[model samples]
Target: MIPLPAGRTAPRTAPVTAPATAPAGRPAPGSVPPQRTASGRPAPGAEPGRDLFVDVLRLLGMALVVLQHWSMPVLSFGDGRIATGNALAAGNMWLVTWVSQVMPLIFFAGGAAGAISFGRAARRGLPAPAWVAARLRRLVLPVVPLAAVWLPLPHLLLAMGLPEQPVLTAARLAGQLLWFLAVYVAVVALTPLLVRLDAAYGLRVPAAMAAGAVVVDLVRFAGGLEAAGYLNIAFVWPAIHQLGLRYATGRPRRPWLIALAGYGAAAALVAAGPYPGSMIGMPGAAVSNMAPPTLALLAVGAGQIGLALALRPCAMAFARLPAVSRVLAWTGPRMMTVYLWHMSALCVVTAMVVVGLGISTPEPGGPAWLAGWPHWLLLLVLALWPLLRAFSRFEMPRPAAPYTGGTVRIAVAAGLAAAGLLLFTAFGFVPGPAPLAGAGLLLSALLLGRTAGPARRNAVPAPGTRR
Candidate 1:
């Protein structure tokens, strides 16, 4: 077992080492947060205390999300319209519900990583503003190009006189994905406060938040306003965020057990019909299990986190292989890019299958032929991998040196983002079509301005850094 660092009262634990020649740019087992310093370099190797299992958790969660979307079958209403009434829609909803919580797991993992990364940044004297900025850059950068690519797609369809509702639905879906970015950005912004809470009171803060979330759910389920459920976004997600902090600090004696209880409780809720069994969507159901996030979803997130942790050993073992390591190393850097591009890839594939291939209707339920569908799915997955790989560069910061800008830039950017959201909601600004051409334009501009050239110059590693 390795000796624990000073100020870390957690028990000593076995070290998880990296391969002898782990990819050059990868952070060490533990290093200072990857954020850039005033000198525009990442802090040198800070601590060798990272858990490879956590990395695998993030990777697996995203992969599951991709699979879930890929397996989804397109459905249409009786009049050849795409709506919620299609027969196959129910099964699709069920499948999505089963796996929807995977994303919450990803959030938990991210929270934990954020906690650890922030601590490392503080140790190296990186200021709070710089830390926040770095994180925002990483999150927003990859989204820029993706938004740009799709900005004109809807307009093209509308110009061709496509049906209004379908065009609107696709545009809405694009915007829905952006919700993750908004929520995640909010979480990252609150990291400093969350870290302080953890440093002072340990898990109690998060535990309270989680309890509050459940209470909120109970109220919402029992005659409270439906929109009240959205409150859990702040309460429950942050509570899970705290769990990530616990993982970073080594405070929990048995994190997995707590996670198990959460899982069981969630299962019970769904089984009892208080909440839907599927965490995704359900056809013919008035309310989606995910629309406002029930307490059961939180429980599922907890369970998923525990499961991921338990599988850490296997992930670490696999990551040790040279060939495996190479793939992991490459993908790890571009995880954000893969996530941003995957939905678009699905749209592309769906278009090819339906329009180009003259397959008017997607197979109902699973693939037309179960075994054969698996092979087709595999091919689709492989086909998308290269495209995802090519897009990875958009996610990485530029290699140039840092440039100075102050609060003005930030304020302006924030104002634009808010204004953009307002316009989108008020006018039903379609991200794709010509009439709503500027729907995502502001967001695109902000993202590009912050990601390209000088913005990227700040991403270099600090002197003497080993990770």
Candidate 2:
């Protein structure tokens, strides 16, 4: 034993450790939260845990999404109504969109997360349906707060004598991002099967999907079947997601080389082919690659996937920094909360600037708006943090453990979530009979009979752990 210093206690002969307990049987697909370790340290050699690279990629995709929404026209008040449109359509910024339009990478990261989650669940004897139910719960829980606020909010605004058009437009923007949520859920539902296909078919699965997308685009353009273009919603993104599936299976053998080639190919197509260079939709553009997800979008998505993989090492290294790691660790679990509330924050800040403060909206393409954007973005971020802290808990609740019946029930939930999100995306959250119906469906899916209130303590998610 070592001698004690002045005013210090002597060390114990042995360091006390947490008593090891036998692993329990697989949870019966309940809505249980994560349990903390008794020793105040994560399990030793926990199975690989979450891949920091994937988390970093998710954060990047989320940041790009935030920036895209932030930069859109806050309030185009000159037309006698509160209107909004993409500000990126202005000036020489078309090239900048090439980098900003990284939505496909979101699905890419999602695919990786899905693959990892499914694999763990399968190992733990968790049934496929329950795993999916849990997965959808994570996605759906965050939307709960947003929907709770917005479902009745539009009606309140209309009753308060707000102008119809401005209210409607704001309603529209509020739910537009739900389109991504709907599509991403579709991709997640397919993950279990996609992983199996990847295991069996190797690279051919992606090749077939890519080829299918191109053929669909041709029919859409040549045969004048604009409806066929919508089919790419199913085709194009899943095709891009396949790239992620391949990556999950240890792919992009030479990520650097692939990134260069893919990017060069996409650029060439946009410059010379039928595709426009802009990755996102733009006003008055005859052929927006994004709207229909043309082959050009796929080309760009391929490039982005390659770029992400190539940068994985760097991103991982940066994420490990002491300060950066602490920030990320704090915010990681609350990411969906930030995303859900940001647009609401934008709406609030926009009104404060335009309506409350009497500052008119700058012209979309003018120099004044451009000069003021950085300042406006800064204000938005500052105003949003408090809202995020207040609302983030809704994203993860301390509800009684949740469980589902069978595959049929899980499928129904997914269908409801997708349909509800689609309605919000296409029609917006207008205070109308039909819109209210959609909101009802959304609420039902989120509630899913969540009888228990959320606990203030955060749920711990560990490696190969179920949340």
**Candidate lDDT (C-alpha), each:** 0.57, 0.66
Summing lDDT over every window of 10 consecutive residues in candidate 2, give the lowest-scoring window: 1-10
Candidate 2 accuracy as TM-score: 0.83
Per-prediction backbone clash count: 16, 4
Clashing pairs in 2: 31-401, 31-402, 398-454, 398-455
Candidate 2 scores a C-alpha RMSD against the true structure in Å of 10.1
301-390 in candidate 1: lDDT tens per residue?
777777666665677676544465455445566677666666566556545654445454345544554544576476567667887777
True-structure RMSD, every candidate: 7.9, 10.1
Per-residue CA lDDT of candidate 2, range 1-467, in tens?
A: 00000000011111111111224743222111122246754332111233556666777877887888788664645443665566777777778776778777877766666665666556546566666756676677667667667778878888988666766767777888777788877777677778778778867987888888878877887787877877888878887777766665454677777677768878887777678878888777888888768877887788788887788778866765556556555566677777777888888887678755667668765799879888999999998999888886655544334344666666777788888878878877776665666767767765553323442244322222224
